[model samples]
Target: MVEPSVPRLWRAVLPICLICFLYLCSFLLFFCATNSLIYSTVCLLRANESYCAEIDQNKSLIILEESIQKESSQWALYGTLSFAIIACFISPIYGSLSDTKNRKFPIILTICNAILTGLIITIASIYQGTQLCLILYIVANIVNGFGGGTLILISSCFGYATDSCTHKEQHVQMIAIIEASLNIGVIIGYALCTFVFELHTRIWHILLVHVLLLVLALVISLVFLKNRSLSQPSTNNLSQKIIQPIYDIHDLFVGLKQNHLLISFLILLFSLFFYDLFRMGSGSIVYLYLHYMSFDDAHYAAYFSFEQLATCLALILLVLLRRRWKVNDLYLAIMGLCLSLAAPILFAFAQRNKAMIFGAIPSSMFSIYFAVCLRAIIARLVPEKDKGKAFSFVALIQNLDVVMGTIACVEIYQASIDFFPGLVFIFAATTRIIALIFILIQGLCVSRTPELLSIMPTDEIEEPILENQSDDDNNNDDELIHA
Candidate 1:
């Protein structure tokens, strides 16, 4: 059979566009679920008696800060801590399965799980008892984290991107584009939350909207997203196929042990994990912390949207800077680290809303750059076949960081909430300094091995075949199918 040739760029364009749209929907689902869960949790904790007054006769009356009090920080801490605990283990498995099977299904599964989680939180928000709501909150976290939450969902999306792109330079650009999509989604979600909170006053309604968006995202995935067959389809029974990903954990260790570049990449990921740990830990509590600063939901949502916009702008700036300067990823990373290092310090000592808002600006602007560079680097470091495992390990690190940082920050905050509400920020800032040092070392390694930057194989082009040559055309068609 004679095969018609298609343009290389055209082959990638459709999948890339679909992935970007999926990212938008998935992140919208993410931000909405997170904002609703945290805001409702905190508000409920602060105003528990209002909902449970008939049942709780022993509870004392307290309405400081208009039902947004210091004690409400505990809900933020517990919810985040519980989420990280389950997600840390699940993310690696999800990543491995993406490698062993396909990326699209795992991503679909995550969105479905997120929808369920949003519904549970909504039910919890409308319930009457504090203990019952907390139990439901814990249940919601378990479901959300069971499929690995946002990190695994994003890693699968990224793994799908790597499957489509073959060149190193293109990988970097695509990763940056994905990071930008995440920022854009955050901004949109935050704005929507702001609008809903201002207009409606009922937090459960916001969560219902979140559930609807997840359904939309799932539909989009089912209709538009294409799954590439990277690995051979398994011949095992359905039960074994389902259980096999858990055992695929060995692949991560094998990839790291067998490949030197993968080891170096893992070291770099360690640095990012520290940064993410502090960043996620502090982020979980920042809204409640802001409440103490006299900021309302509208103010917090608006400022947060502004910060996400700043992150998107920073990526744009980085692209421009790359065009003009002889800068490396590590160099750009250092610049971002310096900005991130300053943010938590400013937050820690900020006595006024202006300082807290200003503190968010620096970290928000450059943090995405660090992530972009890290993902780009890892995408280059691992072989094409192991990209899913590599990204999964990275996701695992993110989950562990979230768990560790949450535990540490929650403990520190609980102990110091009376005397020092800002102590957790100081600890978070210290972790950033540690991450900076690791980045410096990674920068030195990349400088020493410049070849690491261009590690991805370029896409191969097929030579033209005359119509008389049927055998050559069939071989080329088979190669194209495999590619």
Candidate 2:
């Protein structure tokens, strides 16, 4: 009997890779532009006879720079919180919509939101050093959040990939590829920022680049991506349409309450939650920390690009380990947590550029595996129909984590900026330790009940057949399946 032929891995996920690449490139660029704009605005305000002007020129300049850094850090914190707060409420609805309506729509909506956000920020850059500029920044965050921000786009993309694959292995590989695309996008964005800013380009110029990339992403998404959600009957009632997503979310929680895997699921959820909180907490204050160390834009870009590249390499290693050694996802996740614990500790003590760059090395060994494996584990625990809900809840938790992490880290950084800016990194390290404990508990539970997280039986799982097979080929396939 002939074996079934699955599509090549690259072919199966190429469209998603392109879409994610374009979106993340623009996404990273937008943040870099915003940070530059904020710094420029603060500098402009300082030059306009602020409190620092009363001192000697050299001392006054030093005081003025510190003030600018603090204000910019505060604004960054506020912007992150506002966006997360809005996306938190809206992500679940979009997640349900993807499961019920279609995946393409939510993705398109997110790209449109990104485009609008770029435009608003560009306009604000024109009016820098004014109250109107600040207002426009606030408005951009609100609009971006309302459209579900990056959180929805990522969840929807993952859901689409999940729908395309038929088994656990395929799910893990596809998810890893999609995540790698995101990292590659960030690398390109940071590289571009470094090159452009080195040439002394204006802030708006970078913003324009972001808008152009977003437009390309939008076009590619429309043309190349297929709607993968299973077809359901269209509903015409307006109120029902509005409330259905909420009902889906409610149903999700109720289902979770009833599942035997509830404890395991919660353990994974909290583990993911704390890890994200650690990531966001440290990430939100990285620029401030670098600035405090007197590192410039090029330095920051280089550091970020290195970090992203390391993550990509780690993901590649994870795929190899799963394919070559048949490692359990839970064991790999535990290994990842253990390996990554050194990163924040390294960061906490880093005082020089070399020290900071060294931190990315240990992180490269396994920092990303924890999130990817945990996500795959969660995906496997639920039924196919609940994949979207599972990912959506993850998205919601991530945004909420961002809100809490950013606020807490930012406040700590602000309070300790003068005496010890590395306190925030220590805080991040603590969160990772907590996440590690929860994952250890999960591993223990799985050890006792080995079937709890086991993959479905291969014979019971049907491989998707191609549409162009001949009658004889179909008969052969059927024979192979039944044999």
Clashing pairs for predicted structure model 2, backbone only: none
Estimate the TM-score of every prediction.
0.82, 0.90
Residue 194 in candidate 2, Cα distance off native in Å: 0.4
Tens digits of lDDT, candidate 2, 1-483: 433334533454787789899999998888777877776676677676354223222443655566776787788887887788999888877887788877788899999999999999999988977767777888898888988887789888888777766455556667788899999999999988888878877778999999999999899889977776665855648878777767887776677667667778889999999989957645547876776666667778877888788889888887777665667788888889888877777776776555764665766458788888888888888777777778888998999888998888878888877777778888887888899999999878876864674642222322322322245457767899999
- Stretch of 10 with least lDDT, candidate 1: 458-467
RMSD of each: 6.7, 4.2
Highest lDDT among the candidates is held by which one?
Answer: 2
lDDT by residue (tens digit), candidate 1, 157-235: 8888656553444555567767777677777778877787688456676667767767777787777677866789878
lDDT (Cα, 0-100) at 178 in candidate 1: 70
lDDT score, candidate 2, position 30: 85
